[model samples]
Target: MAGIRFSQLIDNFITTIERYGSTVLQPEISSSRPANIRVITSEQVTDCKIFLWTITPGGGGPGVRPESERRIQMTNISGMPLWPGVRTLLGGWSQEFGVYAFWDARRHTKFSFRSPSLQVDANTLETAGTTGIATQFRPTKEGEEVVVAVAPGSLLWYVQNGLPLHNSQDDAAFVVDLAAASPEEERNFLDSAQSEIESARRYDLVETMRAFRDASFRPAVLQAYSYKCAVCNCDLKLVDAAHIVPITHPTSTDEVTNGIALCRLHHGAYDNALLGVKSDCQIVINPNMTNRLHEIGLDSGLEEFKSRLPDVIRVPASIEARPTPDRLRLGLKLRGWPEEQIA
Candidate 1:
């Protein structure tokens, strides 16, 4: 219960700023205990700070640097890691606030930092499920919190805090979302632990085709074969996520047609755009590079590769006309080739 209150207290402190509007100074812990324990348990907390600023900028402010056009200043600052919890708060509401330490009407600077303790609200103790510890990864109570690096899909910041310091300037960014810190933090942690795992998983079949030019050809081939790659025979390892689709293209998934089981070398050739597969499953070396077929000085370094493709075994009796064929054809067009070369 003491831990829960501690979490709740943090929420309330932020709320206090929203309601009455005051600079919040976290209490210094001469000594402390969990909210309900009522016993004094002493501890040490390394340095922790929270710098608040707007989410989306409005117009401009005075500065030697390029001022954000937002009515709010970039409040240029440095030395703060962007926190997810803080982002949630600003994204949710606090962003539009005209009340802040920078406002001329405010008496005290709206910023304060001190020791961090898990002392909950005296009444309703929070932070219950947490394990206490001050690991830079998590502000937990007792157990380990997995640490993770931000993913590419992850937004670095809606607005940044690495700005110049001034009474009116906003700077220093911190993790924004705290209420659900554990889950998100753990997600990041899992990513960190499984970085190699995800990378390996991404190397599955369809991507094998992507290594070649007109990357879509592999998918079209897979889709025609229902993702099985007739020549090499591969399938999605599990079902939750499927194998090859354009990284961000709208259409991609676990369908057999989307899978292609190219051998290791073929997969490499496809992704780097070194080789291209035809709509008819023929190999089309970049014409300008009289080198695709001669890399090893053997007129046949990769000549036998086409026959090794899954397409050789089945050739889709009726020739299903490779769905919407446009994407791959567009890719072909991107290479500036004429119909004769592709067909």
Candidate 2:
């Protein structure tokens, strides 16, 4: 699925409200239907039924402002009292509210509370169940008590350390940012994995949640490096969290220290054993890299890094989180680099 950001959601919400003139409906995270902004139009009665188009904007009648408009008409053909929830879902209530609601003309009063649509189409409702809210991607801890609010389908924000920050910001942008440190630091993969494993075991499930495992590890590694490639210091937001120790080894667990954020090119180089890190946290390109690249006419890509061989990497903040000296030695040993104590 395509990634959606908080800014885009807010912009879409504002645009929908402006275009429709009055009220529009959007899905909540728990909404049964897939998220969509539905415009409420003017009421019209045809034959024995009242037709209201929630899909098309400005087709039925003049849209009413959600913040102020109220005292709506149309009790349907039977003229019976409509459920308050229905009115809320339809964006009928006009009174100022943090949620959606509308007024009832026949009842001569504004209804209280917000309501999301409960439609159950296969592509919509079913699909929504299979996915998460667009803004909330990674897993979070329970009992952490972080205040979060979604502006219906349009936007999402969380209050962290007494400051509000939107998820729309680049993931790297949040790492090490003092204002968001508490929240970002809280996203530890080991903790998340343990939590998920416990949750799954509670249900007696045997299969390991590989997807969940990968999801937890990747973000933890990326955040630790503040989403920048530790080798090149590139902050292009295309970095990958690479494992220092191959998972085939028993000690290769998904710990923050066991991973490094690397760009695609460097990741490939490391995997191919063309690149190695020393116990002193220095990066070393293979001595034969220049000759090899020259033979293949691919020198431009890694020429700079090769020229600057034996450079220091951007070490993580925590000393323990830096690549393990043993792992670095092992990495070079596996690559047949003639270095026993260091790469």
Which candidate's TM-score is highest? Answer: 2
lDDT of 1 by residue, 161-224 (tens): 1111111111011121221233345345335434565434322212221221122233344445
Positional deviation of residue 198's Cα in model 1 after best superposition, in angstroms: 23
Q: What total of clashing residue pairs does each candidate reach? A: 56, 8
Cα lDDT tens digits for candidate 2, 1-343: 2222334433444353333222344443322211234443222111111111122111234654222212222222222333332321121211122222111122312323332121111222122223311111222221111111222221111000111112112221222222222222333422343455443332221111222233346666877888778888776544777888876565566778778888777787887778878878888767665577779897775756677544778988977777788887776666566554343
Give the runs in model 1 whose Cα sits over 4 Å from its true position. 1-138, 142-261, 272-275, 280-300, 306-323, 333-339
